[model samples]
Target: MPTPTKTGKRTSGLPAKTRLQWSGLSLAIALFLFPIILPISGLDGPQSRMLGIFLAAICLWVTEAIPLTATAVGVIFLEVVLISDAAIVPVGADATSAKVYFASLANPVLILFLGGFMIADGAAKYGLDKNLAALLLRPFGGSARLTLLGLMSITALLSAFMSNTATTAAMFAVVSPILKALPTRRARAGVALAIPVAANLGGIATPVGSPPNAIAIGALAEKQIYLTFAGWIALSLPIVLVLLLFSWGVLSTVALPVGTQLELEMKVDFDRSRAAIWFYLITALTIALWLTESLHGVASTIVGFFPVVAFLATQVMDGEDLKKISWPVLWLVAGGIALGVGVGATELDKWLLGSINWQSFSVLWLLLLLALVAVGMSNVISNSASANLLVPLTLGLGASISVDQGTVAVVIAIACSLAMCLPISTPPNAIAYATGTITNRAMLLMGLVVGILGIILLAFVMPFYWYGVGLLPVN
Candidate 1:
């Protein structure tokens, strides 16, 4: 037993995790005060204040000293109090209205995400996701190698329309029995690794696929650059497909190996009840509206609310079902939007742009550097937070570089999703790691290969491909 401390608490009373969280919170405060105590040479008062908030947000987000959503909402509150019109110590010229910061909580991008979350939640409630996986997996046959491909393909496809984390959970729930049935542990690890790798890569396929994607879209919208939902799919889907196939090949070869034979028993039991059927129709119509935005001239954000209204009004998804939606994810994205808004409103972006001589690096090198930095930061922090910090700054580079804001924002977003080396890198990665089938070494090796390949694709190949195909504006 541990000795009691002065405060009558045991010396070992707090868990290591709790102690670390408190330490992180302390560090965040110190970092936040740094800019205030020692102002930068060129930034104005408002800029310095924004810089402090930005640093503090990075520390809190990276450490998870508080709940991720708490840190997000905290950032918004600080921005309003410290730099908005409501600030106690007034700063001239750049201060924005408090409403602007608060409004981020319901930004159109978030509304779009909310709609996606509703559909995903409804799918899970009605057993639609699992049933779809079962129906889709039938064509790939029983061999472990082919099954790996089938599983990855389906995971990626589902992740495109759903949260990658949710997709991984749903997929894993479907396959956990098969994993236990596998004779060799190595085959289990291989099969297990495929789900997260596919889900992470697949998240880049559409704007609503992951939080980072929504972060990118939200940031770009503030700059008057809008990417239609289908447009994002067109830009990223090809790369997502190629990376999934590549990862599938690596996992099948390195983890599963040759001569590994396994059989799977997938049960398909989709709900055919009245409410489930109504949900299905609403979901299909919403997705169709999202995809045909160009033809219909309906904004994806407006179309996103269709399901929200339809599900609630018809009782297809009642209040209980609504309660199941991932509210934190939406808030996290909103915090990112508010961060971008504050940075832009304060002209901190201009100051930061001037602080760096971005022209010193060639276009190719700069793009590579941005993607590499995004991957590195996201490996240890929430990818959404990484995008939150990086996107606004990258968008500022539009004035300094010849590349369009869309390309830069999307590159960073996709690069963030490429981080999956550690269990902490993503919820999907954590879920896959929790199954105890794969070792840390196995995950790191696969994540590194896939991450490097993805970086190379984003930095070198995709830009030119986008330009050639007219997806990117030619410089």
Candidate 2:
């Protein structure tokens, strides 16, 4: 480490981290200019340039060359500067190109996440998360397998409605006391691994569960295909449940002697304040509204504001509390939305889908293709970014394939969540890794086994599940 001089300023040339950032940034810029400098076949004009921008954005996002939100901001800048024809001359408010690029800022999908963050923040504020976890889990007692599964199940339940990272962080806090009370490393690893693993699995169960699921829903709705909140959960819950059980088994092997009885006092005493009670009521109300959206003809976006307003009113969260919400995440989601919009506006989505030759492909082949593309990319890139990059492409195929967009969307989003092999794959994985408890080799072995099972299972079950749900045709 460089030390400060007497003048209180360190004299350093450049750090390795800074150099890496510069290198990644330089490579991203080069990739951005690649299409413009040397035009490709079939990508001759604006599409080529825009494709360059997309690829560069994807590169920077995956590499962490700069802040992901800043990369998104850069994308907006490029879109307006290079492609915003409406900005050159006003088109009399008929939805300008510049406006299209930035439309995601006001996207309802993002609003849903905003409300979720507020609820999560409020839950943390009043210790409701710990109390809820303790009450639900205390029944398991000392039965090790049940305890392990119970921990994962509760973690998953919370993740089904909130951010997985937040859920995992909160769950880990609840479990740290348990981990210390456990005698063996094996016992600790079992519960420790379960937290993040469960978070990833639960995240795919609903639109509000994860950014990728939300991305799938938003992209599908753009094509006139929509799913009620319950509709999405019904389609995905089976997958989450099965994967959770399978992961528990895999983790049990690594966590040998998992049968070892645990004796931690799972009871947590947190008296419910009025703020906490209001938080629960508002959160429940918001979820109910989302589930019954089709019945009442209420869009989830309109219902999303319920918690945001109610939380502040009850003093569960004040105005300053809004700043605690993850603004970068909002920016990141907005960027994905903007990218999806650009892909459609430039007809690039159509062109890519048109090239797929859907008639020549069977459903199995298409499913495999999507799984490979999504899972392979997600292992290296963040799952949200993976979904953002691919969901738009998949959405474009609904017309060409004559298939139900809802079915395809569910399968693809789940596939993205199967990327659990690396620490950098997701926020939950990173959190688990930072604990210094589980080794990378352990994560790699266990995660790959679970990930492969998830992919194979998703491929087989999705067609039958959707057909039964009446979303896909029974061919």
Candidate 3:
């Protein structure tokens, strides 16, 4: 009955807005509480509850209810104050040190990831990624579909050596100029979306392609499920090829124009600069080190560190540029590892797997179900955390089902990397969305379709191919 405003807007009380905000907050609180509250009280002890709380914190970060960095800090606080009665001690001590908070920080995998990022940052700053993209795209003869294929292949290849987010960002630097010079918005958007999809798809080609892959590899190694370089490649390459072709087909048929002309000048210096040569050399060494870990016993971290040192020593990138690296992402990965370790330490993974009913399903069906769950969870959580949480669970579940644990672990890891449903699902997708070329709705729709197809390939095709080719142990 109150009079309408000049703009014909209804007058709403402050109480109403406050109520709505409180309602949302309450819903979030409920979600955080439900897992712990609904479960049997004594079945999961304090450690298990703590793990659940850690996971809930990650979920809050992924959903943007809180900043991811802040969530990591929250994890440290929770671990110290609530989880254990153990006293804090100095760093460089044996077990039971205050450095426990930094336990995951010292992991070899983390060191390798940081070192790799340094190298990638150097490559990006030195125009190596741009040059590589230009070299690859230049030969496509200006056909949009062919150009799309070239972009996908190049991005995928780069992904094997670099972080998927970094690879996608590099690809964008090259492709954005081309898109801007195009005449139509539709063509620009199509190419823009294709770039990220390609980057994500390409990331499946190597163990170091994405965080999820690294997590899986590290987790399996801890379980003594060792896979050599050739072994992993034998399993991954076929899946990667099939998925890459599928992604290219989807973009060509669904989004991209058949006969679009590019008006931009493609000028790139393909000359091998000193820095580029050094980068290539470091990359080759890293790959060699990873492949020959058995003979040298040289940790991958040591191999990765050489590139970082070379980049700095050669003056390829300055200190300020290094500071701009994603520290929050590093923290998130650290916290995810801590939480994963905590889960195993507390035996929550075993308890959770024990509760699941795996009796009725075949091993293949169980693996497929796990893959679907990994894909869905990765969409809502950071893929690294998804991998951390699920890999151990998959291992335990596999034991319960009397199937090979390593096989289930690898499947979950791969599926975690396949998340493409939303920008928040993976950093590469977020990087692509930030370019302003693709709408959220378009990305979501296209990603959902692509993700479904990817899951299908992972579930039905990959296991057979891996086992048939002698890459994976047959049951």
TM-scores for all candidates: the values are 0.94, 0.90, 0.81
Position 249, candidate 1: lDDT: 87
Least accurate stretch of 10 residues (summed lDDT) in model 3?
A: 89-98
> In model 2, what are the clashing residue pairs, if there are any?
none
Best by TM-score: 1
| Error of model 1, residue 338, in angstroms | 0.8
Which residue pairs in candidate 1 collide? none
* Model 3 regions lying over 4 Å from their true place: 1-55, 80-101, 180-185, 228-231, 255-264, 270-280, 291-297, 313-318, 434-436
lDDT of 1 by residue, 64-103 (tens): 8988899899989999888998887777764799999999
lDDT of 2 at 324: 86
Query: How far out, in Å, is residue 179 in model 2?
Result: 2.0
Better of 1 and 2 by TM-score: 1
lDDT of each: 0.89, 0.78, 0.70
| RMSD of each predicted structure | 3.7, 3.4, 6.9
Supply candidate 1's per-residue lDDT for 159: 93
- Model 1 segments beyond 4 Å from truth? 1-17, 257-260
lDDT of 2: 0.78
Among these predictions, the greatest lDDT belongs to: 1
Put down candidate 2 lDDT per residue, 1-475, tens digits, no spaces: 6778898998674445566677788888999889888967676456776787788887788788888888877777776666666544232243336876777776888888888788777777777777888888888768677778789899999888878888899888878887887777766776788899999998988778888887887777666677777778878888889889888887766574745776557768775777677777788888889889879988887788778887877787897889889888877777777777777767667777776579898777677778878888999887878887788767677667756666677777888988888888889999998887777887787788887777777666667877887755535
